[model samples]
Target: LQKLRSGQDFNSSHQYPQLLPRRHCGKGLIDGEKSTPSATLYEFPWIAKLFNRALGYNCLGTLISHRYILTSENCINFYFIPDLIVLGEYDNFREPDCQLEDPTDCAPPLRLYEVEYVVRNHNDYRYRIDLIRTTENVAFEDHIQPVCLPLTSELKHFRPSQYTIAGWNKNSKNTTGIIQKETIYAASSAECQINEEHLPHNVLLYTTSHENVANRTYSGGPVGAIVPSSERRFVQFALVISPVERCVVALDIVPYIDWIRANMVE
Candidate 1:
């Protein structure tokens, strides 16, 4: 488990170099190579694709479920009904360089589905505007599979600790449309609360860039935790992305697991 750094100063203006290639070079192999998914906010099962013929640009999204996806509400609000595609168990953007020796490859082909709708949290506090936007309960289509909501009782099990996050976010300002991966540890509520003072609401968001970069896009991404199961295996999904002030510390308003089951589930 990764230890939390107390009083660690993360500057918002420090710039970092671009780590990965922008376009798919078709070099990275799928077999043997591990997929470092983004931290929660960027690690949605589905990638959102935004395209404006005149502007010429696009974005990606993580799949929450067959129907529902947890992404930045702002991204969707700005770019509505942009083409969306859900890639299942997809680790590499380029094709596999070598033949797959693992049995999982033969288990079944990962399905690529289309997004039908989107639902954002109405309760999500929006800044930069006087009008408050109500959170949408849910958005999905009949054909996609929905992820199960963790019970309220399950919240106690998820503590601030080590976990994996994945996404196809820009690695640096010079690049465009490349997926990068990073791992982050959970922050304590006290730490989050302290940082919230510098932020808009009592919300905190996560990001790989400790310092804010010009094109560091991490608006609507998944922020999940890996928890231990009774079978000695670990399961993830402690939180989903919600609006927050800044990405100072890897903090965001994770929908309280209990709150989700109370309102969204029967």
Candidate 2:
């Protein structure tokens, strides 16, 4: 049994490398000639301060509702507190820095909110050793809304090919920091699972580099699938970011949404 376990570990480990650089820049409403405004992306006021202060930075999250934002558990570690600004309809590239000077005055169509609660998955891999769990719901101070949790039974029905991931990760191999929007299609679980650059055990071995993985600043960003609504509106909220081993493309496995509802939501 021990040998089997060891072999399983080795096989899984060999499937992925410790790092995989992002090769494609995704297309989105935020990109292109007639792009969505930068304000549409969520931003954190306190984190913006940290960014201006020259502390290390990362990006990870998605807007699930007009009010609620969904992101990875690790992203909370990057901030000192939950005071954040949701950019709703911005376009200027330099607006993030300019808004930092006067957060109230910045005309970036920002909706400032505070995190009220945070819900995290109990099965979060990071908890394997420390058992230190985080809450998944980060409730807001204002009326910013909560994202609808995907049904547990529906997770298997999710087609990996039908999803998109967006973020502002690094753009170069040598440079350490930059904030830019990029997107990529979802690769198959088997593809992700078999890739030697993202094995589970290796992810545990190299946590810090994992944070720096993706090509255009993914980190704590959102991986979502657009589900059509009866009313003709499309709702997108697929995965919340989680830490993984490899640096290949900063794409950590999103905890199964069903698992999140069972463990985190009230």
Candidate 3:
């Protein structure tokens, strides 16, 4: 707490180039879980809650950098406009969110940032992605950090057999703000074609959910893939575009990796 208050270096990239092996990307979640369940305190730290002017959480976004958030164009569409972005938050109802298993273990207070502006992809582009710039650079901590983007050549072509989708439970009965996760597998070409969803000749990458996304609103949520050979590090390869009944459609991050990097600056 003192370190966080005093603004001490919590192993920034310069101090530890790898963002500290302890809090690397996708470090949370115990191994071996097949069903959707409430996530642990520090799982998916990059998940950001988007809030509108009314101060209500509207959608989900991913922390891709200290100053930028990666979201979907639909989030800032005609109906919803997320003006505030909250990080390091596990439960919306409580501050200094603590672990359910261990009351003594708690995360730091959630950090809120005002959105400076939003940049949308070219109107001609088929994918719907938006980059949000925050007024201030978010401080990185154990419970708040950026996720790994697919920038390397290997990651660009890499595909995992199983993917993880993490976001808040939108069920009216359970609005505790406890983050949840579901495991989804890559749909075969026959399944993708069955939907009759056509993509541009150049845009050949995408995935669909096998079952309902646990009734969770994955709009702007992260579709994470486990990195091979890494120490359980997960990479953000896609963002949830929409949920169609029991099937969820997502846009591949590889197509927008360069666009994201180019617009990361203010």
Model 3 C-alpha lDDT per residue in residues 74-102, reported as the tens digit of each score = 77764666778989988766777998878
Candidate 1 stretches greater than 4 Å from native? 1-62, 78-80, 89-93, 96-112, 127-149, 169-179, 187-195, 198-202, 205-218, 231-266
- How does each model score on lDDT? 0.34, 0.33, 0.70
Please say which candidate is ahead in lDDT: 2 or 3.
3
Best by TM-score: 3
Residues 145-237, model 2: lDDT tens digits: 222334434533544443343344345455422233323344434544545444443131112222234444444554444344432112233
Quote the positional error of residue 170 for candidate 3 in Å: 1.2
Candidate achieving higher lDDT, 1 or 3? 3
Alpha-carbon RMSD, each predicted model:
14.4, 12.8, 7.9
Which portions of model 2 show Cα errors greater than 4 Å?
1-57, 65-68, 78-82, 92-108, 127-149, 152-156, 169-213, 228-266
Name the lDDT of candidate 2.
0.33
Where is model 3 poorest over a 10-residue stretch in terms of lDDT?
A: 1-10
Candidate 2 has a TM-score of 0.45
Better of 1 and 2 by TM-score: 1
| lDDT by residue (tens digit), candidate 1, 126-194 | 521011111232233221223323333554445646543444434544442334444555554454445
Q: Provide the TM-score for each candidate, comma-separated.
A: 0.50, 0.45, 0.81
Q: Give candidate 3's error at residue 252 in angstroms.
A: 0.8
lDDT of 3: 0.70
